[model samples]
Target: SVEGSTGLIASLFNGIKVTQSTMSEVMALIDSSNTKLEYSSQELSNASKKLSESSNLQAVSLEETAAAIEEIASTIKQSSANAQKMTTHAQSVTKANEVGKNLAHQTVKSMDELSNEVNSILEAITVIDQIAFQTNILSLNAAVEAATAGEAGKGFAVVAAEVRNLATRSADAAKEIKAIVESATQKANMSKEVTDKMLQGYNALDDNINQTIGLIEEVANATKEQQNAIVQINDTVNSLDKATQENASLASNISVMAQNTQELVEQLKNAVSNTTYNELSKKRICDPALIFTANKLKSDHIVFKDNNFNNCGIGKNFTVKTHNECDLGKWINAHKNEKFAQTQAWNELLKVHEDVHAKVQKTVDLYAVGASNEEIFTYTKDVEQSATKVFALLDKLREINCENKS
Candidate 1:
């Protein structure tokens, strides 16, 4: 029978080894799976980080493009300003040329009047020459007539010659005046022609000025358009920059989540490694000897009063509450099954609880039956004292079980 007992004990140990090996394998598998999950989370985080970086770069590029657009708009504005100034200058030149043309026209009219006056003076000189010639001829005839009168006739002839020379000089002066007037008229006509050409040139310049104004207006409009476009670009770039910043923030959060996941995986692996169960044979109380020991002190008699000992016609009160009826039913069912009925520790613990209940119930019954408070207290104290011994024994048994598990 000792040999059979030893064989049973050996079999129980073997079962324990098998259970431990199985638990270890499960823990290792959980660790590996956790590691894989953590690695996948980290990969996702890295991808997010890269996407954030790309977004940041795109934001920078957008900003640069916005700045470039702004620069082009500024240049357009400057060109427009220059065009406006040029248009103003062209208009001033055209006005000045118009004033010059007016002055030239007036000068031509004055020159024509001067030429007419010169012609009138020439006519007057011709009339005077004819009168002088007639007078000179009359003087010569008188001189001839007087010749018969000696020296007096000779003096008259000299006077007629001097008068004739004076008339000749007057005629020469009139001819010079006529020639000067003719030259003046030609110059005035040339001046008028030149003024007309200048006026035409001024007209052309005016046309150019108008064209320049139109061009400048076009440039101004273009500049305004460019400015508006640049403003839009700036706004877009700012939005992109903000989005990139948000993306970066999101990436940071994702990275933190990945790291936390890795840590959680490690914690899960450790938790799995720490959890284990004893062999099935050792987990229960199944021996006939243990059953006999537990049944020795069992009683069905119920006490009317509640106490720390004996049956109180009530179910056992657990210190900790279960979640629901399902959990309670499962625990109760498991206990009723008593699959490990040979477990000595379990039998002994149940016996101790039964003994304490019986003692406490007896005290409560005494108190209910008009016993003094001091007597009830003394009886309860003795019952508690016995319960303490039982607790010590249970603690030692648990320690032995822990040592065996280790």
Candidate 2:
């Protein structure tokens, strides 16, 4: 009984030591994990903040674009309306020109009729002149015969001479009327020529007006089509703006959640730290190298060196250089005075880098669930690719800065 009792006591003591050691390591690991979680949350918060800011900028751009589209649409509509008005005016002018040509033709016809009437009047005047002349000649002959019968024929001769004088005056009056009629006929013929020319001019004007109307109508139709297309584009832009707004709201929510996660991780770190208060005297500064170990069981993110990124985390027989992770803290501190941080496109790229980091962080959980080695490799490759994109984006921002200075 003494021997058995002694054996049982020793086994119990050994089991307690093992449990204490396991708990101690668990506490340390939890503290380290808490650090990584805090960093991840802050990174997520920053990324969400950037994403929200980008969304705001995009919304503003969309609003301005929509306004510009509205202005253009207004201008286009005005132009189309003016075109329509011009078309109406052109049609009216064409109709009026047609009327004018008809009037001109009628005027030419009237002028011709007037000329015919004038010619008839001239012919009547000529006939009058001939009759008057014949009358004068007959009266003169009578007067001569009366003179030959003298004394007894004296009164007859006087009457015959008076008749001859009257005929002579009448013939002179007829000639004067005939001369006036000839002048009237000449003027009427000239008027007919001018009226004919006016008719031709009116006809030509009508044809030109018709052609102008056709061209204006075509322009109006084309302008209408352009306006319709622009309206559709405006609608699409509005939809995009709405989507961007929704995205901004989502980013804001993510930022809040990140902040909450950081708080929770801090609490967990404190609770674990409290469990090992007696161990603080022996505690060394946190093993920063341990944070970069390729083992996801200990760390959550890929460790990218200062300048080189191709060899992410670590490989077999690989040694780690003592450097900060991603240089993000330095990058962020330097960004305070850097104009690139304020750039919309640059901030967007930053968000993209953070999003990729988030996806890569998910691999830690996957590894805990016994994910396949191939699956892990695939995720790691994606992280590298995303890191390359981030570097390229930074280069682009530098390019923009250089160009601006130049």
* lDDT, each prediction: 0.57, 0.67
| Best-fitting candidate, scored by lDDT | 2
Q: So what's the TM-score on candidate 1?
A: 0.52
List clashing residue pairs in candidate 2.
none
| Candidate 2 lDDT by residue in tens digits, 83-112 | 999998988888888888888888888888
lDDT of 1 by residue, 238-314 (tens): 78778878887888788788888878877897786577633332322223232222222121111111222333223
lDDT for model 2 comes to 0.67
lDDT of 2 at 185: 77
Runs with alpha carbons beyond 4 Å of true place in candidate 2: 1-36, 271-406
Could you tally the backbone clashes for each prediction?
Answer: 14, 0
lDDT of 1 at 228: 78
